[model samples]
Target: MTGKRAFVTGVSKGLGAHLASCLAKDGWQVTGVGRRPRESAEVSAAVDYLQADLSSAEVIGGLVAKMDAVPDLVVHNAVTYPDRAAGRPELDTIETTMRVNALAPYELTLDLLAAKPDDQFCSVVVINSESVYHADADSAVYAASKAALRVLTGGLAAACRSTNAAVSTLMLGPLGDANKVEEIRRIAEKRGATPAEITRLFLRRSNPDLVIDDFIDFDACYLSLRYLAELGAVANGMLCRLDGGSAGTLV
Candidate 1:
């Protein structure tokens, strides 16, 4: 992965930020696009930050132009967490969700492929959610969008077969975040235990055959990226589920 170029979306924080940092550490030139401004100096130094909202087609087009040339890797990790308490989602909400989650990535991929030479190798990784399989109270639209993304990835695999570009989708489960850890930590403190203990208990309750314990942090997910990158270097299309053994059999 050394000296490879990667374009990552949603690098403002969380897994996106972590992915950017890990790729940079591996000696890859990373460019991260996010809606928010880059705040951390570490993240800022790890990748070139481009601030743009994915919801607008115009903004996405501008982003495409800025790339100059197609990158070796394109990671669609940016997402909008729906407001579950908003009751039945409005038409606008559903439209925005689809646009940001599925449409933007699809369009950006096409543009990148178009900008590249015929034999250039490119890899696309879409960070999807397990919610597509098990929808929660407020994630109906979100789940649908991810499902569409999965379908899109399949189509892209076929479309890019002769173009030397590989497409992959990673259906992830509950990823750990600072706020989630803090909340769990408070509960663990009340119960006279550590956060790691509570996290293990939670995972055991979630699934007994958990492959990786602890929250799905940057390090855990980074392995998936590496796998995809390696496969993309040779293969055309691949779908992987990384939900800590909760997805059962790979369908």
Candidate 2:
């Protein structure tokens, strides 16, 4: 499969771009959808980048309509949050974020397979956050959206049972700066609590007890491609963690 077809959303930066490049290197035909296409020579050379406003359902619908075939692999890795702490309307803000995080992915996954309903040609991977567990005061909307996306994952997993395709959920934890630890430290200092007190929050709460892998190395992207590829059609509806452990994990 020199040019195995693959489609990935939110591929302008972060883990999405990394995943796209890894897939390309692994001999897959990569179609990456990004909102604001950037000037990245790496992305330009290896991947076919499509600039589309995924936040708008109509635009997303159009992209879906134009898809050539059911992608052998679909990686849903886009999200928007409510940093609009800047006097934005609450309903619209939440709606837009949820639409990006949850609704759009659900719709896009279905869109990928709709044209060829009988096509059981591959895996659909969803990128989610470890924050899917508990909610902080400031992160209520974000956590809710991810929780809903997980539910969608479960539903889609069930739907794809008879088919040959599979689903993989990569629950990516804090990585690439701008994440937890710091947020927790802020809360700890504000509450006049010790660092241990904040650290305790991550020490396994009842619900998922989701763990965040401390470091994010580039190798995790390659590992994910091989993991999904090795699973073939055996791993529908499975959630895989990308941990940059000292030894690393391989399929």
Residue-wise C-alpha lDDT for candidate 2, range 1-251, written one tens digit per residue: 55788888888876677778888887888888888755752353578888887789898787866777777888888888888366444898889889999999988887776665574577888888767654777778888999899999999989888777777787765454335556767888999996556655544342233344233444675577568756877778787776322112332
For TM-score, the strongest prediction is 1
Per-residue lDDT of model 1, residues 1-251, tens digit only? 69989999988888888899889888989999988866743364769888889999899887878975779998999898668787888888899899999999999988898888877798998898877776666677898999888888788878987778888887787789878889989999999998889998988886655666687776778898888888864545676777876666554
Alpha-carbon error at 237 in model 1, in Å?
Answer: 2.2
Tell me how far the alpha carbon of residue 106 in candidate 2 is from the true structure, in angstroms, after superposition: 0.5
TM-score of 1: 0.91
Off by over 4 Å in 2: 38-44, 84-89, 117-120, 177-213, 243-251
Using lDDT as the measure, the top candidate is 1
Give the RMSD in angstroms, all C-alphas superposed, for model 2.
6.2
Clash count of each predicted structure: 0, 0
Alpha-carbon RMSD, each predicted model: 2.2, 6.2
